[model samples]
Target: MKVNGKVIVVTGAGSGMGRALSLQLIKEGARVAGIDINEEGLRETRDLTGKASAAMSTHVVDITDRERVEALPAELIALHGAVDGIINNAGIIQPFVPIKDLAYDRIERIFNINLYGTLYMVKSFLPALLERPEAHIVNISSMGGFIPFPGQSFYGASKAAVKLLTEGLYAELKDSNVKVTVVHPGAVNTNITKNSNVEMRSDVSAEEQASMTLSAEKAAEIILNGMKADKYRVMVGKDARFLDLFYRFSPKRAVDFITKKMAQMAKAS
Candidate 1:
């Protein structure tokens, strides 16, 4: 869980928290193998990690491809001689609309990448991970996974699966050296909406949206620190932390809060 000198595989290290996490890990002396669907994004992440074509670096790979993910452990092991950790961070939040209005194809794509992608990464690397005396798994869920949002039902569902999956892994690995952590992040200042096929409920103003509810760097810092502590659930921002409390203490109130937030957005638009 210590970032320094850890051989970590990070999926979807193209942008957002994934990118920031990769940079943070490398800075802390971790040897990172970064993967992303966006090769351009990977390049940017590589630049952030270090300006070198070193043994531990970034590459372009789609997580949704089962065959590729299956072969990943071998590839990584061949290069690094071991796999110490895996970050199942590849995800998509497309078709950000009501379930009824969302297209089936988009839903499938979202789940395939968000849920299945995470599963495949874990399945492919678990056996290898078991061999290591101490290993770790970091999954990135969303605030939507724990709370509800009007226009992102499918996204929420996919991440909720990851959240549960992470917890289950934690329970199973309790006595083992393999650590599992799921991170729930609030509105981060990432271009997720622009990059994703998801339709926003309301277009954020240029300034406000640009400002980001949370900075990716800050979120990444918190996540790495949480992993070091072997935290079960990491809420990246105040909003994420607060909603988690509401979900536990007053589930109905959280729903009401979401409903009201949606209504306000509708009125504002």
Candidate 2:
């Protein structure tokens, strides 16, 4: 569905891809209700909107809070008059450690924010979306959701859950006006580690880091284009696209490749 003149609710709108998505949505003539847990970050996002600030509203919301999430649809509709689309863009990565060394609290936190958070948003706003003439739901999964990255196993598992959940929603809502799209983004230059409260140590040179990751702005553009076309699956970055094909062709080989890469990264660090 075209975003022009629609009201879109974007989670994680404080910074990174979410902020970029909010800005781009407003540029496309859509009103945005930006949700994030950080009040300062939300304020920064609102400030960055410039003249388009009027087209956006910032909400400091923690999507993992079920009650708060459930209250969003009503609040957003009251503010925007109607809700049309939702982008579940808020998520976190687990600590760069093996699952055996990972704590239960960390695992729960990752799943809570990444998986259950998406679920709550879907359930809360799906009714509102259904009432609209046309609506869309976009969930941000990761390339790790499909391909294995040794240290990020749990993070990948949570995103993989998001992948299936989004696909399942698509199947169930196929005949309805509500559309669903699942996105798999390869490494993007963002503050996800800081946001997730996980410190990352890497020995990779700065040049290599720049080459591997896509910019947040470009990632948002790709996502919006996919949404406009109502695509069922959207893969961001060349890395994600290549792996989507590669993993499908040879899952074991893809896994082995990632295992080796992660090993090298660990050794370097």
Candidate 3:
């Protein structure tokens, strides 16, 4: 579905890809409702939109709160007249540790935000989305969703759940007006570690970071293009595309490759 002239809702709009997507949607002539837990970040996103700010509205709400999420459809409709699309971009990562060392509370938090939060937004807005002539739902998974990232096993699991959830939605909504797209993003320049309240190991090299990550603006553009074309699966970066193919042909080798790399990074840090 074309985003131009549509009312699109974007989660995690306070910063990173969410913020970039919101601004880009506004540029494409879409009215956007930007949701985020951080009020300051939302304000910053709105401010960055400048003249296009008139096309956007910022909502400060925790997506994990079912009551808040369920209320969003009505709220967005009131502000924008109708809801045409939603991008579930709000998610957090687990700490850089093995699952054995990971806390249960942390695991729950990761699943709640990455899986349940996406589920909430989709379920809450699905009815309204079906009412539109053409609507779309985009869920952001990760490269780690398919590839094994040793230290982030739980984070990978949460996103993998999202990947499957989105795929199932696509199957169910095939005959409906609402289109579903699942995105696998490689590393991108963002403050996810800070927002997730996890400390990055000091040893991760600058080169490693740069090599794997995409700019948030570029990632947003790729994602929006995929949404416009109504793609069922979108890979946000070259790394994501490459790793996806790598894992498909050699799953064991892919796992070993990532495991060894992460171990080296962990040791260096």
Quantify all predictions' global Cα lDDT against the true fold: 0.85, 0.95, 0.92
Model 3, range 87-198, lDDT digits (tens) per residue?
Answer: 9999999888888998899999999999999999999999999999999999999999999798889999999999999999999999999899999999898889989999
Error of 1 at 25 (Å): 0.4
Instruction: State in Å the error of residue 115, model 3.
Output: 0.7
Q: Give the clashing pairs for model 3.
A: 203-269
Top candidate, metric lDDT:
2
Off by over 4 Å in 1: 51-55, 199-204, 210-212
lDDT of 1: 0.85
TM, every model: 0.94, 0.98, 0.97
Estimate, for each residue in 1-269, the C-alpha lDDT of model 2 and write its tens digit.
99999999999999999999999999989999999999999999989989989999999999999999999999999999999999999999988889899999999999999999999999999999999999999999999998889989999999999999999999999999999999999989989999999988887766787677999999999999999999999999999999899999999998998899888878888
Weakest 10 consecutive residues, lDDT, candidate 3?
203-212
The TM-score that candidate 2 achieves is 0.98
Better of 1 and 3 by TM-score: 3
Show the colliding residue pairs in model 2. Answer: none
